[model samples]
Target: MKMTVFGAGYLGATHAACMAELGHEVLGVDTNRGKLAKLEAGDVPFYEPGLPEVLRRNIDQGRLNFTDSYAEAAAWAKTHFIAVGTPQKKGEFGADLSYIDAVIDELVPLLTDDAVLFGKSTVPVGTAARLTTRVSQLARDVDVEVSWNPEFLREGYAVADTLHPDRLVLGTRPGGRAEQVAREIYASLIVDGVPLLVTDLATAELVKVSANAFLATKISFINAVAEVCEAAGADIAALSDAIGRDPRIGRQFLNAGIGFGGGCLPKDIRAFMARAGELGADQALTLLREVDGINMRRRTRMVEIVRAASGTLIGSRIAVLGAAFKPGSDDVRDSPALNVAGQLQLNGAAVTVYDPHAMDNSRRLFPTLDYSTSAMEACEGADSVLVLTEWPEFVSLDPTSVSDVARGRNIIDGRYCLNRQDWESAGWTYHA
Candidate 1:
């Protein structure tokens, strides 16, 4: 199958490359010339583990390409996947659908024949049906079917997730040809035992946001427990271990840390709540507001812990261990780690950050904060160390070596992944 994926950002780029890896010819289209140029040159604009190699291999094998023109993309492939961003609107919780709307507006007018547009962007419910009507209005003498096929790729593991998805969902109107087209596009995965759920368009649109909302709820639930444990002088790690052993409550996002943050969860829950309010079912999702609050409070708690550990943040040097939201990707949007670092910086603390892959992105997001090449370098003369993101390297750091470099042997484990005994043994005051 040959397909054009519009909006070549994180989701679009990964989907394009992974589609090519699945033995399809893929053209990634975007308005950003720099992003297109980077993709064409086999350089991924963002940090994703194993994505660069997959992209490079697919492009080198002549199965993947990129372009900035929607007309060219329309002419190139009958199948189009809209993987554009539907980020939260400024000063509002609802998603800004201008980008998704622009893709349809630009491409539908240029289509001269039959086409199928799979909306892979996470969007508000009923968007696909609305876009279907819009596509019908714009397309001339052509049969264009709009379907919802939301992506479930994680940032760090996007390549693996796309190449071997756990499930494939295709949402279309009754009697539409989208099912057949999607079957052909995902035939390999279907054969590999990836279950395909065929549903109405609205259900497909709801799946992605619902999944994110549930995951966010889970993280916040555990973080809320962490708060109780803090007040009770209990260890969250032990509690998590005991409860996680129960099969009904699997411990995936149960780690109680400076809670969930990324591009997706923070805005998705807010959007979900906002959408529910618009639908007159606002009370049902009211707990998500609490979830959002708990997540934000964790970052604040981290700042308080840092301030307490350092005695006084004013004129103090603090080493921030990670900047990205998580361990494997360089995405700092709504990152709790960066939020903590920023708060400390605002309070007159001189903060230095170190991350394996997120340094450049962190600098771009926060140019004022100082960054270091390595953890040791970041800790040099620091009053206290704050391990924010649980990067594996940070987890395995030699506390003795870090102690020698720091002016003060004070460490706060925001992620709760570090060994307290080891840090204490190294003569560092360990706080969780």
Candidate 2:
């Protein structure tokens, strides 16, 4: 299989490399020459576990390459995958579809032969069908089948997810060869027993956003209960453990934390709601408004906790232990930890932040805050140590060592990942 993946960002880069690893020749197309150069040199622009090796190996094997020209990409392959970003519109809940539209507009007009363009970007419902019409207008004499095959890759585990997806989905229009083309493209995974669900275009576009919305709802639900637990003085960790044991309510995403803040969950849910309203079904997803509210509230709650821990935010030296949205990846977009750090700083707290992988990105996104090379360095002379991202290094930190250098022994576990007894016994005040 030879295919071109538009937008060589996180999703496209991973998909391109993984497809090449699956014995396909893949050309990653991106407008950013710097990003394309990085990909071409086997250097991943972002942090993802095991992605560097996969990308480097595939590039070394000559199965993967990158380009900036849409005409070159069009001439290279009859199959194309759109994995561009669909970020939320500025000051609006709806997603900005200009990136996808750009890909379609730039790439479709160059297709010299029959092609199948698969969408792996998470989009609002009816996007594929709408784009199918647009493709017809631009493709001219060339027959281009526009289909939806939304991606479900977690940031840190993208490689594994792509190489061994739990399931495969393909959405196609009537009388199109997308189903056959997609199956042949993913034949290796299909042979490995990965379930494949074929559906209409609208259904496939809805699946990705719906899954993200559900996940955001679950995280917010747990955080909402954590709020109650705080008032009643109940242990959210213990409560979560008890409820998670139920077969119907699995333990995944149930951990009471500061909240989920990544590129996907936050914006996807908002776009989902906005799209529903546009479709005259806004009332159906009204509860998602509360879900978004709860998630944002969790970040404010953490700031309040930090203030209480330090007695006041003014002139306080706070050590923020993590900056990435999650532990395994260095993506700081809408990161809850970084959000709190910024808020604390805005409140006149002298905040020093440290993360194993996200320091560079965090520094770029937030330059005012002090950045430390190591966790211990960040905690040095701090009034309170806040573990915000639940990284393994932070969770496993020696409380005694951290307390040794800090002016105060106030430890706030924003992720509920630390051992309460160990920190408490170490003469540190533990707050989650």
Candidate 3:
């Protein structure tokens, strides 16, 4: 199989490389020359565990290539995947679809033969139908089929998730050839028993958003319970452990922390709400507003915890232990860790931040805060050590060792990753 993936961002790059690894010839297209050059040179611009190796190996084997020309991409392959970003609109909850629109406007007109465009970016429901109409207008004599094949790759474990997805979904018009083409492209996975759910365009479009909404609701639900646990002086960790034992309510996203803030969850739920409102079914998803509020409140609550621990925010030095949204990746988009660091800085506290891979990205997003090369360096002379993202290094840090470098012995476990008994045993005042 031969294919071209548009947009060399996180999702696109990984999908392109993984497709090549699956024994398909793939070309990655992007307008950013710098990003394309990085991919060409076998470098991943962003951090994802095991991605650089897979990308470099595929490039070395001559199975994957990159380019900036849409005409060249259209001419090279009959199958295309749109993995562009659909970020939340500025000052609005709806998704910004200009990137997807650009891909359609640029590629469809240049198609010299029959093709199938599989949409991988998360978007509002009805986008596939809307874009199907758009393609009809832009395409010429040759048939161009539009299908919705939304991606469900998590940021940290994207490569594995892509290659061995729990399930595969294809949303296409009834009686179209898109399903046959998609089956051929993902034949390897299908042979391995990865369930493929074929559905109408509208159902496929709704699948990704609904999954994200459920996940966000689960996370916020646990965080909301954590709020109750706080007021009643109950141990959330123990309560979570006990409730998680129930076969019905699993404990996957139940970790009571500063809450989720990545490229997907925050924007996806908001877009889901905004789209529901546009469809006049806004009342159905109204509780998501409270979910969004609960997630954001956790960040503020973390700040309050720090303030109370320090007794005074003015001139306090706070060492923030994580900058990325979650461990195993360096993505800081809407990161709860960085958000807390920024808020602490605004409230007259001097903040030093450290993350294994997110430091460079965090610096670009937030330049005012101090950055350190090591966790101990960030903790040096700090009034309180805040564990924001539960990176393994931070979770396993020896409290006694950190105590030697710090001016104060206050430990705030925002992610609930730290062992309270060990920190308390080390004579440190612990706050989770």
* Deviating ranges (above 4 Å) for candidate 2: none
Cα lDDT tens digits, model 3, 1-432, are 989999999899999999999999999999999999999999999999899999999999999999999989999999999999999999999999999999999999999999999999999998988998999999999899999999999988999999999999899998888999999989999999999999998898899999999999989999999999999999888988999999899988889999999899999999999999999999999999999999999999999999999998999999999999999889999999999999999999999999999989999999999999999999999999999999999999999999899999899999999999999999999999
Residue 50 of candidate 1: its Cα lDDT? 92
The per-candidate count of clashes, in order, stands at 0, 0, 0
RMSD of 2: 0.7
- Candidate number achieving the greatest lDDT relative to the actual structure: 3
Instruction: In angstroms, give how far residue 362 of model 2 lies from its true place.
Output: 1.0
Residue-level lDDT tens digits of model 2 in 1-432? 999999888899999999999999999999899998888888999999999999999999999999998889999999999999999999999999999999999889888899999999999998988898899999969899999999998989999999999989888988899999999999999999998999999998888888899999999999999999999999888998999999899889999989999899999999999999999999999999999999999999899989988999999999999999998899999999999999999999999999999989998999999999999999999999999998899999998998889999899999999999999999999888
- When superposed on Cα atoms, how far off is each prediction in RMSD? 0.8, 0.7, 0.7
> Could you tell me the TM-score of candidate 3?
0.99
- The number of residue pairs in model 3 that clash at the backbone is 0
For candidate 3, give the lDDT. Answer: 0.95
TM-score, model 2 to reference: 0.99
